[model samples]
Structure formats: structure tokens, C-alpha cells
Target: MSTTLASRASSTASRPPVTTVRVALAGCGTVGGALLDLLARHADDLTRRHALRFHVVRILARDASRPRSTAVERALLTTSVAEFLDTPADVVVEAIGGSCTADVLARGALAHGRALVTANKALLRTQGPALAAFGPRLRFEAAVGGGVPIVRLLREGLAGQGVHRVRAVLNGTTNYILSRIERGDPYAAALAAAQRAGFAEADPSRDLQGVDAADKLALLAWLAFGADPSTLEVVTEGLPRDVDAAVRGAARSGRRLRLVATAERAARGVTAHVSPALLHLDDPLAAAVDEENVIQVTSASSGTLTLRGRGAGGAATAAALLADLIHLFQPGTH
Candidate 1:
């Protein structure tokens, strides 16, 4: 019996034949550059563990001369979207943010029949359902929760669990700032610190205005409620004008201030909001300090499930992109 079991286990764990997945990457900034490093660092491990190898066939960058990772070969760089699309690739990973160029690239990739993976929540806020028309060919696991994998959890793991409510700390920048404020740092200092830490961008208007969280919440509403994200009118409220006072007050009351994005299904329809909310000390949302994200999902059957993880930075987003690539091109997935 032991010999038979050993044989079965060995067969199950045996490395399958390696499959090379060609990837056309757009943007070599933080997320894209991190992906290149990850690919190079894990080249051997990916093949050995999953029997898969990823080859970046083309890289679309605005300025090809910008200094980047040593793993990014200059030969693969292209400035023209047309030329980038012309490259033979199994997948196109879009890490270049914003709605304009990213939208163009996303539509172009799907039209060209190449699988698309993106971390562009802004674009998805307005065009998610349309891109999702391509079905499994489009994956945006990095759009909502950074490295938290909330998108996959809703799309795959809880597909039919009849999920009805989603509450999350979706904007890591704001969360980081708020956490700093809670720790006695002034709002400006907190924002500046977050910027220096790469948790906040130079122009963090979207994050500070609650637009970023609203965008992510819209995508989550779409996934959780089957609503069209483009049409969702989320009631958004940013950080308080007197944020320091609010944090001090909350702390005095044994509470924490967190920017919470929530969506719930009701008879009237799905209503969503992105605003700063106060939570008690023991609340899970309150524990999501700094750049950490916490998502609380409530479903009919699963009751309530919580997912928590680092929800900011390039490496986290890049890992989500890599996971999408593996899912799309894994030998037997199709």
C-alpha cells in the first residue's frame, strides 16, 4: 500500500511539460518593472513548479530611454501601440494607469484576440462590463485589491454564493495617510510620508478626493452584484477637511478613521458609497493600517468572509498580473 501511494503521489507532483507564454507588456513603471524583475528572478522556479515559462515579446513605453530594470531588454521596447499589438503574444498586461491610453490598449488587445490583464481601475470604472464581454480573455485581478485577489474570489471562488454586500478599504493611499494621522502625524505630513513611501502618488487628487476608492468600489459592485460599473453612481466623500480633528476625536472615542468603500444590494437596487467611516477598535476594517487592505464579503451561504493583505506597491500589483498570466496561459486552463 505504501509503495502504491508513493507512486501516485510522485505522479501527481511530477513536473508537466513546460509551456512558454508570450506576454506583451504596456508600461514599465513601477508595476511593469516589478513584473520584469519577478519574471527574471522566478524563471527557473516557475518552470520547475508549474511547467510554465513567460516571455515578454514586446514592451510599450512612452519613453524607451528611461532607465529601468536590467531584466528589461531594450530590444523589446516599442513606442507605437500599433507595433506593440503587432507582436505575437498570448497576453497583453497593461500596467500603465489612467483611462485614456489604457482604454485604447485594452480594447486593442481584446480586439486582436490576445488575452488582456490589467491593473487599471480607473479605466475599468467606466468600461469594465464592456471589456468583460471578452469573457475569460480579460482578467483584472489587480484592479480592485492590489495583491488581495478580491476579484478572483468574487468571480471564481464565490461565483454562486449569492454575495450581497462588500465593504473594503480599497484606497491604500488614503488608508496609509489616515493610519499616520491616527498615530499623531498631521494630515499634510501623513500625506507626504505616504508619497515618499510610494503609497501615494505625487498628485494624489484622485485618492484624496475619494475618486480612487469609488472607482475600485464600482468594479467590486459590478463583480458582486452583476451591475454595470460604468453606470454606477457611487456617493463619494473624501477625507474630512479637518481630518486631524476627526482622527483625534475618533481616537478619543476608542475608534479609528478608515476610508471605507461599501456596496450592498437592496430592493431599490445596488447602492454604493465611498467615504471615511469610523470603526471601533475591534473592527476588522480598523485593523487595516497603513497600506493594508481589508475586504469583508457577506454572502447567503458563506456568511461573511474577510480577506486582508498588503494592498499597495508595484510588487503586489505585479504578482496579481503574473497570476492572471498563469491563469490565462496555463497549459490545461483553456
Candidate 2:
């Protein structure tokens, strides 16, 4: 097996000259900017390892004049979607987020028969089926897990397995707040810390209200059980009003507070929810600290497969986006 694998790797590396994949990037914010840096820093390694080179042809940003990284060329920045879409490219990566403008870009990309990779869970939760109707050219490995690759696991690694349940810490902001609360920080202080660390936005209502986790859970349901994410109604409950008290209560009982997103497929139907739950210290979910996420998939064949990693931050999300690009355009992947 080792020899065969080595031979296959050698053959793949030796088979071709560099294949350049043109990319049209939407959004040059945190995730998009990090992607540009990743592309620039790892260009040679990506070519050597995968026989693939990435060339960004166009960039879509809200303010084209805003100063950006040196990796970005000023000439490629465009404020108009029409101009961005008109540029020729093999793949369109949408990291601007939200459902309105990002939705338009996603549709435009698929309309032109180009592959779409996005990190926007809100867009996917609402318009997943509509975009998926275009084809499998839609790839969103960054929509849920930041660096965890949970999407790939469900889509390919467990393709035919009987997946029954998915339990995860999908919202890093909530998890970080909870972890801090458990460690004796006040709720306000914990939230402030999360914001300072880039785990929470200044307006963190979506994360605090469980909307972010619910959106991610919906996408996970689509991947694991073939449910339409756009229509899956997740019963979501956010952080408790008296979260500090709840944390103290859980601690007294040797448990920790975690915002847990759960989806279970039953004979009757599928049920999903995002709410704060108490987990014993021994629980795998309890071991996740700060912005770390742990996703556990319970299936008939795979039993319980748990994946853990940094679940938030621009770099982690950017890396996932680049991973999707490599997966979609890598040699022999199709």
C-alpha cells in the first residue's frame, strides 16, 4: 500500500506541467485578504504538490479604493458585479458573506457554468437548493467548519454511510464566551474579550441569538441527511439571559456550558436545534475551549467520528476556502 501510494503521488506530480486555475474573488475583507496572502505565500508549494497554480483574475469589493494587501492588484478590484462577472475565470470564490449581494454573485457564477466556493452560511442556509440546482460545481467547505473540513467528511468520506446524528460547537463566538464564563470571567468581559480577539464581530447578534449556529446546522443537515438547508427549520435558542448564573450552576455539578448545535434524523422526521447545553468534563464537546469546535457525527457504519480544530478567525476560514479551491481544481479531481 505504501509503495503504491508513493508511486501514485510520483505519477501525479510527474504527469503534467503547471495547470493555472483562474479565480474571481468576491470580497477582499478578512477571509478574502487572507486567501490572497495564502495564494501568494504558498504558490510554489501548491504547484509542486498538486500541479496546480492559481491566478486571481478579478476581485469584488464594496469599496474599490480601500487600501488592501500587497498581494491584491488594484487593477483587479471592481465595485460592480457586472464588471466582476464579465471577467473570465474558472472559479468564483464568494467570501463577502450575507445572502443579498453574495447571492447575486453566486448565481452569476453558476449561470456562466463556473464553479462557486463560498464561506457564507446565511446565503447557503437560504439559497442552497436554488444554487445547488445549478450543479455540483457549488463547493462551500468554509461555510460551516472554519478549518475542520467537516463538509468534505460528510460529502465524500461518509457518502454512503447512515448518518443519524450530528452534534457540534458550530458558533465560535458563543463557545468562546461560554468558556470564558466558565473560567470566572463576567459575561460582559467575556464578550468583550471575544470581540477583541476577532472571534465576535462588533454586532454579534447573529452569533448570540444562535442564528449563526443554526445556519451552519442546516447546511450540515443537508450534507448528512440530504435535507434541503433552505427549508430545514432549526429550533434555535441562544444564550440564556442569566448565562453567568447558568454557568455557575453547571460548574457546581462538574459540567460546562456550551452552545451545542444538534441534528438527529429519526424515523418520523429530522429534528435540529441550537441551544446552550451542559456537558460533563469528560464529554468530548466539553474539551473544546476558546474558539475551538468539535463536530461529532454518529452513523451506523462510521460509529462516532469526531473532528476538532480552530473554528473561527480569518486565517482558518481562508485556509478552508483555499482547500476547497484546491479540491475543486486540483489535478485528477475533475
Candidate 3:
């Protein structure tokens, strides 16, 4: 036998076989359901290709009887946070939206030394550093840009790339509304359409008021510039009541109105903001229509790298979570 093959065989024989990793998922909403579907559909491939497999051991939800896509066993569902945390899990995935519950679940998972994967931008932006300091394995890849992999780009691919600025359109709900309005639909009608499409929440004030963008940009600022989310003075302004008029004015000026989220380093610190702005006809951001998100990163050595993709919906968020899961289970898989 070849020497390399002998070494591989010896290593495999000596090490204990890695069993399927147990995962406790919080929230069975859109993103959670999509994740369960993804895991179920690709379980065999994940094991064979990456030597990784996950079994959803427990599901945490306010209503244990709520319908979920995964058809989880009744015994695996729980309404109590304590019960969910007590389950033996190698990792915890939090798709819950609120800050209060998400914070507790995140802290509990970290206290138990379990790897945490979350899609909660609000919690991460508000308390990420503190929580990340407690656990060495916390990841929030799905928080910022859905499935765009911007977090991985900042944390790993561009670790030494000296990124200086990040400009993006991070809120897909607002983008969808604006696109529809630009196409002659009224803002209210557009917003209703977005909610119908599952791109906007029923309470879309967060997205329409630019809070969602602010939260996402705050997290990105922390990752890229080490700016504290609480300390950063983020100026935010949403689409004005006269957004349609602004879009028309921009069109007359050969421009388009886009909700822009920008983070730049200053001598004092990093400055971040989200607001409606005009993009020239040829600008890449101007072409980002509907629910698409585009991020442009300027690095010292790498210049500008822009990523564009679907920025909302369950499938995209679930895909980001899957990427994070693969990274955690098989660091060399990517």
C-alpha cells in the first residue's frame, strides 16, 4: 500500500468515529423551516462529501404545536427555553427574530460551550461582541447579507486584505418596496406586495425606518473596523414619504434612488449610516433592483469586491446557515 494511504488508514483507525452532531434549533419560522428542509434533503450528501451530519435533536418554539416543514417528532419540540437548553446539543441554531429571547438562548448555548449559529441581526448588532467574547465558536453568517457570504469574506478571505470601506444595500424589504414604487405602484401597495411575498414582515417599520439596515451595518462595521456597535454614531434615514417623487427626480437626473448603507473609517473612528441616496445610471448599486442586495468592499490590496444576490426569504437565509454549519463541522470543506 502507498505510504499516504497507510497513514490515512492509521489515522482513521486510531481516532474515534465522529457521530452525527446533535443540533437544537430555536424558532421554526420561515428560515428555520428552510434549514430543516435543506438538512433533510441533503443529509446523505453532507455526510459523504464533508463528513458532517446533523440531527435536529430539539426544536424551541413558543407554540410547540405550530406546523413546521420538518415534521419534527412531538417529543423533540419544547416551549420552554430551559428545557431546550438542557437538551444535549453540539450546536445551536437560532433563527428567532426578537432580541430578548435570542439573547438568552445565545448566552445559554455559549455558557454550555456549544457552537452557536444565528441569523438574528438585531441581537448580534446589539450584543455580538459581548457574546462572542464568551464563546470561541459563535458564528452569525446569516445576520448581515442573507446568503452573500460577506461575513466570511471579512472574517477569513480578507482577514489580511486591509478592508477600508463597505457600501451596501442591506435591507431587501425596502429595496423591494422601492423597486415596486419605481415601477408605478404606490408605496403602500408595494409594501403590501412585499409582505405578501414574504420579503417584508408584518411589522415592517423596522425595515422601512432603516433600523434593519442600521443593525446590519453596525455588525459589519464591528467586523471590518472593530467599531463598537453601541459607540458608532450611525445616521439613519429611510425612504421619505415623497420617495416616488425623489425617484422620478433621480431618473430625470439619470440616477436612481437606492437605500445605501455605508461604513467608512475615520481618524476618530468608523462612521456608519443607512439612508436613501441617488445612484448614477452606471453605478452597480443602481442595478440592484427588487429584493437583491449588493455589497462593495474596498480593501487596500484587493481594491473593490462586490457581491450581489437575493438578500431575503427563507431559502437564502437557510443557505447561509448551511454554509456556517459546514464551516463549523468541516473547516476544510469549503
**Tens-digit lDDT track of model 1 for 1-334:** 0000101112234566677777899999878999999999999888777767787889999997888778789999999989998887778899889888898899998887788999999999888888888666899898888899999999989999999999989999999998888788999999999888877878999999999999999999988998888999999999989989999999898899999999999999999999999898899998998899999999999999999998988889889988887777665676
lDDT score for candidate 3 against the true structure? 0.85
C-alpha TM-scores of all predictions: 0.93, 0.93, 0.91
Residue 318 in model 2: lDDT: 90
Tens-digit lDDT string for candidate 2 (151-182): 99999999899999999999988889998998
Q: Candidate 2: lDDT of 293?
A: 89
| 1 or 3, greater by TM-score | 1
Question: What TM-score does prediction 2 earn?
Answer: 0.93
- Per-residue lDDT of 281 in model 3: 71
- Local accuracy by lDDT, each model: 0.87, 0.89, 0.85
**How big is the positional error of residue 44 in model 3, measured in Å on the Cα after superposition?**
1.5
Candidate with the larger TM-score of 2 and 3: 2
Cα shift from native, residue 229, model 1 (Å): 0.3
Kindly provide the TM-score of model 1 when superposed on the true structure, using C-alpha atoms.
0.93
